[model samples]
Target chain A: MAHVSIPSYWKTLPQRYCLIGMKCKNCGTINFPAREICISCKQKSEFEPKKLSGRGKIYSYTVIAAGSAPPEFSEQEKLAGSFPVAIVELEEGLRICAQITDYEEEDLKIEAEVEAVFRKIYEEDKVIRYGLKFRPVKKRKSLP
Target chain B: MTLQKVAIIGVGQTRFGNIIDKKAEELFAEAFLEAVNDVDKGIDISEIQEVYIGNSGVGGGQLGNFSSLMTDYVGLTGASALRIENACASSGFAMRAAILAVSSGVCDVALAGGEEKMNDTPRNRVRYWLGISGDMEWERLSGMTFAGVFALMAIRHMHEYGTKREHLAMVSVKNHKNGASNPKAHLQRETTLERALASPMIAYPLTLFDCCPISDGASAVIVCKADLAKKYTDTPVYVAGHGGSTDRLSVFQRDDVTSINSSVVAAKRAYKMASVKPEDIDVAEVHDCFTIAEIIAYEDLGFCPKGKGGKLLEEGQTEIGGKIPVNPSGGLKSKGHPVGATGTGQIYEIVNQLRGSVEKKNRQVSGAEIGLTHNTGGSGGTTVVHILKR
Candidate 1:
């Protein structure tokens, strides 16, 4: 029932699942989801597929109320209520937008350290779409 | 060979709100007729050699070949017609096309207008239609709506510039107050700062009152060669300048999220063409789809320094009685945003403001000779700026 087709979803899997980025060989700039041309250098130079480290911090965020959830996300909203979405600034210096998962409202702050985790994005046409979502980094307890 | 100059001989717009009684054709006809009647000298509809209609086909009703349908409805069936689609800036680009058609000597007279019927669509479908304007694969898939996108900007802006929540509410208060005087406004009632701040949150940092409502409306304007403008109307508003630009579609792709680079580039081109600075503009109709948008427009249009937009509003500088009167027609915030119709609707307001013909005396900017209209498609991905002078 999603607008995206099966092949379209499949095409995005590498970038979606692994946070694969395209680094412009000419200018040393990285583009999220990969691009043939570098945005910074405006060159059609060769691009190398680079895996982005999942560690990042929140740049900006918003809590989508239940009423404003898009139809495609209705099922998710019904199950989870309002959810927080954020622009996560990766350690590689590229900013990517994704839903922030497994965090309390008070904990969602700008510059909050987060790490990408694979999770279910949504299900449509009887196929579940899985992608990366950022969550607050959990601190490990000391072994006493 | 010198290119011809373009002038707007007439402009018209229906009361912007829910009008289920009339279909799209009827709405376009009504605005078209009003524009024709507004011309100082009579003009035959058949003389219109070219027509450019702006429409997003939001409801998916009569999407294909819509330009011909509108012209045929208005009895200009045989004339050349085309539809321009740039999301909310459709009509602004349509007007730009009409100016080019007249200025290039391709046609002596042309029609540019836009119409949309958004109120009748189902809520879920409405969300779907509006969502596609943004990056569907990434932004929408992450549950970002138009409001959510802007909300993100607002949060970042506040973080960097110390803009208070009150600064955002003030936009709604000022625009709603102005809309109260205009008869055509959809939300004609005014709201206080307290109420705007307290309104339910659609997206954080942006309450319900920050967003423009979905409405059904249409608007039209007639453009002709400036040399031949005297034959049609003595008060013809000259199309002093026009500029348009496009940026990266997704917000994440841009280097700066606080400002819209397209608006800045478009406004610069327009100012250069007109040989006029922002201070020369007596009145303006900038895209105020949300409060933060208008604030960003102020900076992008050079009305104030970057990050000073919030202070500009807080100082009452953009009010009707202030140094630069903006959105005196209530803007999209109060006047209503019917998608495709919004761009030309801004033009309609500026034309009337330039002519000193605004129905409400209090809403009129005094001695308004030069005016500007800033129309943006989607979240500033595309923008068109036009300068008008009497």
Candidate 2:
């Protein structure tokens, strides 16, 4: 895998942010990156962008051994030898595909709990890039 | 009831194999000529008033306009021609447009066709061509390819509906068996479920066998007013119903990859407008670009309840004798996918079923009077569903 690239905004954000979006006030549907027009209802609406809850269930996942790598992981061979990618069903109802950072590709199961965390994927120069890939959410000290 | 009707008086297709000798225009012209000639009762090319060409991979032309290059070769020039592209569903949408124009009384006769020549282009280039269909800003940026997208969908279906990995192999086994009976299919050899299951995986749960092959071919269908169909052929197929809707182009934007509601929306409209039920269709050629796609299609088209598609496979309901035969033309699976030409190609097969002219044997459903074609653009983002009747 190769050729995955990211923008400066996500790379340089002060806090780890999972890229998420909200539906327009005028239209009751959601969109990514927030747009003025609702794609479904076709209304020129505005969405209030919001950070994701960072937790979701694994909708689907795969262990892709082939295909081009994203630009951040130009050294993808080190990452690609074995990796997990999942289509996480965010609690908000939108399904998002992201890399699973904390597990082996074989460990993935359908509907497993998961959460997002910003990981410094690579550093080409002074810019240490980050991506909003996911990790299976372990139970946080239940009943504490 | 004077509901508008459109008849495909002519049809054509390039030989189903890789070719390097000619450009796309040459292929398009050749297929168009064959289609024009397929008009048995006799037709003149000059009478073709408009042209709608489907091509997703024709590149470097001064204009992205595909019809400009082929109308002259097909012996029809200066006719109002427009290109129709909806990814792999390009030709299907082209057929819908042609049907609409004739049914709307705008055109007496229309030439609808699609072609793609992609042998010489490297695999990576083909990947790039298809990559534009998904979310280029996010999914594509993450290096996800078409197979990757469908792979994701397959995984999601498994998670949500308990779709088994073996069920994916069932699709390949069925399509290959059907393909074995299709003379023009890219791979006309039957493969067992075990063989399909054991094939190398392109993406997890989806093997090389789970995917359709890249094809270099062209197809054409001539549409005319329904009343005029009797003048050309005794058994003219009617476009009983059609529905098309667009979903979010980006995979990430879709509510759920496995739950493609766009398909249900389009299919619902087509079924309602036609006053026909899914169970009434005798055969169907779904866009099985990947095996999982066909699974979702069964659910989306209302052939079965949502989440029951996998059980449909296990029960053999989609097989020829079980319930309603699906992808009997081998579908995009073994039939090969030429992107722009796939939609028309599926229609070609369905029409043959209605007309009783399928050259290959063993795969044909007995007495198939009604058929359906489902074509999509960029995952499930855009879908066009057509119901054809004899």
Best by lDDT: 1
On TM-score, the candidate that comes out on top is 1
Q: Rate the local accuracy (lDDT) of all candidates.
A: 0.91, 0.78
Q: Give a tens-digit lDDT track for model 1, residues B1-390.
A: 677999999999999998889999999999999999999898998889999989988869999999989998899999999999999999999999999998999999999999999988988899888978877788888888889998888988899888778999999999999999989999999999999999999888899999999989999999999999999998999999999999888887677889999999999999999999999999999999999999999999999998999999988999999999999999999999989988889999999999999999999998999999999999888999999999
Q: Please state what fraction of the native interface contacts candidate 1 reproduces.
A: 0.64
Off by over 4 Å in 1: none
lDDT of 1 by residue, A1-144 (tens): 457788987998989999889889999999886777778898898988898899999989888877888888999989987888888899998889899999987768889999999999988878888999999997879999
- Residue A61 in model 2: shift from native, Å? 1.5
lDDT of 2 by residue, A101-128 (tens): 7775445887788888877655655665
**What would the TM-scores of all predictions be?**
0.98, 0.89
lDDT of 2 by residue, B1-390 (tens): 254678888888876557788778887877787787778888877778878887886333424556777786666887889888788878888998998888888878998888887676776566566667666655654546677788888877887788987899999898888888877888888998888888876667788888888788889999899889888877678888899888877766676677676688889998987899999988999989999999999999989988999899999988867788898888889888888888888888888887777776567677888899999887877899999988
Residues forming the 10-long window of minimal summed lDDT in candidate 1 chain A: A1-10
- Name the weakest run of 10 consecutive residues (lDDT summed) in model 1 chain B: B247-256
